[model samples]
Target chain A: MQAYRTLTRRELARYFLTSTGYIIIAAVTFLIGFSFVVLLLKLQQDSTLMPVTELFYITPFFWLILLLAPPVITMRLFALEKFSGTFETLMTTPVSDLQVVLAKFTAALIFYVVMWLPLLGCVLIVRHYTSDPAALDAGALGTTFLGIVLLGCLFISLGCCASALTRSQGVAAMLSLMLSVSLFLLSFLAKELPGTSSWQAQALGFFSLVEQMHDFARGIIDTRPMVLYLSLTAFFLFLTLRAVESRRWK
Target chain B: MRNGLMIQVANLTKRYAGHTAVSNISFTVERGEIVGLLGPNGAGKSTTMRILACFLPGTSGTVRIAGLDVFHQSDEVRRRIGYMPENNPLHLDMRVREYLKFRARLKGLSRKQSRGRGDIVMEQCGITDVSRRIIGQLSKGYRQRVGLADALVNEPELLILDEPTIGLDPNQIRSVRQLIKGLAGNHTVLISTHILPEAEMTCNRMVIMYEGRIMAAGTSENLQRLMSNTNQVIAEIAAPLADLNECWAQTAEIQQFDVSPAEGEYFRCALTARNGLDLRPIVYSLARERGWYLRELTLTRYSLEDIYVHVTRPDEEKEEGA
Candidate 1:
């Protein structure tokens, strides 16, 4: 428990102390602000009755931020340690592989959440300018942020697994980016197919991030997606633990 | 617990996909003894150390640290061992003091204990001045010292240092040697170095490894005695090389001899005796009787490097023959 805390603390501080962490946050904030400005322009042209926060999720900028931030945030967690040979020093200490994996995963997840905090700022700015509480429905905003957190959990764990598999940060980042892009394509696959009521589409719908976010934006908290995201998060964390343990075999 | 043995290995072997890294090697390190694992590169020294550190698993056999099984009770064993791996990898982004404190915490030290121990180790390693400096910007020698401080922070019973003085200047090497020697009798140290002089200077006993197997294990003097019973005799004489070789070959005490030109009109003859006899007198008298003027004659025992080469050389020849 002490080891886990220390590792997590160190991992978290690394994000704020290094330039890469700030670079990730800066890129993420810029995208979110750009998405906000584009959302306002769309509102002005279409005059849609959509809440600003709900419309924010539909922007390509939001999806792009989600897809790119996790890999950059987690690419160095294990790969950097392996490259610099600190992985050996770390493992030889009195910490279990599970603790190390969980610590890194938690740190990356927290950093992902922090990166997304600027979106809340953008929403607040919308609320302040519109002078209407309904434009930022508290319940919908709550669920939307919850969905974002869940997505971050799964994506960060995937990135952590990728990082643990290799010693190159570039490879880890690329591998996770490919994985996340493929995962995002699942939502596209679900929408492009012919039958919306078919069992295959239903099964695919369960894996769709778009459908989940759509429901979340309208203040729906379905237990099914909640369970799915949490379980997948745990599964990827398990894979990371195994990847870390594989060091012993070599 | 088992007769004060700090480390014990039996029939330990590690086989990768196409090769065996460590092959059925065994050795024991008693408490408070500085044992050096001396070998060339790829001699399986690092592999063996890794297995002992519980960073790598052995294919078969058992490794016990402080009488605890390494594979099964690795966490318990790890608490007692502080390992400084080859190349001394560290988190370069962190300050030295912060890194040491973090390592202490990871090693299960309490907050107060880690702080105190961290300071003491920094002082011990002579890195107190740079404790606030970022490790990435520090000099190599300072970075190496920070690594040492980290290993010592846990106050572990066994210190496994792999090439601790490697890539250091002579002065840095001397200080690090002194630091390691000071650790003896308090913590059992298992250090590895390919430099024979380093082993000779720092270790109480050495396990000489070659090709993933231990070729010899003992004190330097014991290894020297084990390799041969003969001491070498060097004599510089103003004589014909043929006459000198012929005379030395006929001498019963001189088992092997080599003659090379020493200077203008002088040849230097090096001879090994059949027994552990001093050959200086024998060479002097032979030169005096033969009317050859002898300029210098000295009896010198084999050094650690000679003994190391002597033990590891035959296997190379055998492999080439096969």
Candidate 2:
């Protein structure tokens, strides 16, 4: 437990000590601000029935931040250690492979949360100007942030697994970007294809992260999507553990 | 720790995809002994040390550290070992004190224990002044000391260092060697090096390896005596070449002799003894009996270099032959 804490602190500090951490925060903040301006202008023109919170998530800018941030945050977790040859020194210590994996995963997840904190600020800004009680629905905002955290867990674990598979940060980042983008696209298959059967649609809906986010933004917190995201997060973490242990045999 | 044995390996072998790195080699290190793993590059010295440190497992062998099985009780084995691998890899972004504290905590020390040990090790390695400095900005020598400090933070019972003096200048090498020697009798050290004089200077005993096999293992004097039987005696005498040859031929102890003209009247004579015998007295009596004017006579026993070359030569020839 102490090893895990120390390692996690070191991993988290690494993100801030280098310019990568601040660059990521800056990029995400800019994208959020841009998405807010565009969404607010569109809402004013169209007089849409969708709530403001729901409109916050479906923007291309929001998806762009979701697609890019985790990879950038996690690419250096294991890959940098290998490139620097600290992986051998770390593994030889009295810590288990599971601890190392969890430390890196948790640190990335925390950084992911910090990156999206600006979105909350933007939402509050909208509430302050409009002064409408309906715009500040507590339940919808809470679920939206919860959904974001769950999704962040899954994406960050995917990035962690990808990072463990290679020693080059560039390769790790590219591989993780490919994995997350493909997963993101898979969530939209049911809606994109016109010839899908009911069962196929149901199955795709069960796995659709976009639908989960929309439901959360509308104050609908179903246990099923929560279960799915949590299980998938666990699954990717398992893959990461196996990838970490694979170094011993090789 | 069985019978004071700090490390024991039996029939250890490591095979990569296409080649065998360490092949059925076995050796042991007792407690508090500073043993050197002397070998040329690619002699499996690092591989052997890695196995002892529990960083990797062998293909089919048993390695016990402090009487604990390396594969089964690896956590216990890891807690007892401080390993500085080849090139001394470190986190370049971390401060010196932070890196050491992290390492100490990772090695199972408590928070308070880690802080105290970190300070002690930093002071011991002479890096306290640079504790606040970022590791990336430090020089190579300071970075190397930081690696050593990380290894020593836990006060481990056995330290496995692979080529600790590699890539250092002479002054740095001497200091690092002195630091390692200072750790003797408190920690069992298994250091590997290819330099003959380094092994002779630091190690109380040496295990020479070649082509994944144990070429020889003993103290310097013991290895010299065990590996060599021929000694040489050089004499500068003013005598005819034929007379010198005849004198050496009459002495049974002289196995071979070489003669070359020195100055105008003196000839340099080198005689090889058959059984490591002292030929200085024999050469002096022979010259005196023959009324030959002798200027100098000295005997040269086998040095560590000669023994090392003698052991590693057959493999070189075999590789060339194949």
Judge candidate 1 at residue A248 and give its lDDT: 73
Report the poorest 10 consecutive residues by lDDT, candidate 1 chain B.
Answer: B224-233
Q: Candidate 2, residues A1-250: lDDT per residue as tens digits?
A: 9999999998999989889999999999999999999878876786666677788877888779888999999999999998888999999999999999999999999989999999989988888888667867888889888988888998899899999999999999999999888877777897876666778777786778787788998888999988988998899999999999885688
Clashing pairs in 2: none
Model 1, C-alpha of B253: deviation from truth (Å): 4.7
Q: Which sections of candidate 2 miss by over 4 Å? A: A192-194, A198-205, B1-3, B237-271, B275-293
Per model, how much of the real contact set is kept?
0.91, 0.72
Q: On residues A1-250, what C-alpha lDDT tens digit does candidate 1 reach at each position?
A: 9999999999999998889889998999899989988888887796677777678888888789888999999999999999999999999999999999999998898888888898889888888888667777899899999999998998999999999999999999999999989988899899988989998888888889888888887788999999999999999999999999997775
Q: Write down the worst ten-residue block by lDDT for model 2 chain B.
A: B224-233
Top of the candidates by lDDT: 1
Listed for every candidate in order, the interface RMSD values in angstroms are 0.9, 1.0
**Tens digit per residue, CA lDDT, model 2, B249-310:** 88899899989999889999888889888888887887788899999898766788988998
Which predicted model would earn the best TM-score?
Answer: 1
Candidate-wise lDDT, in order = 0.91, 0.89
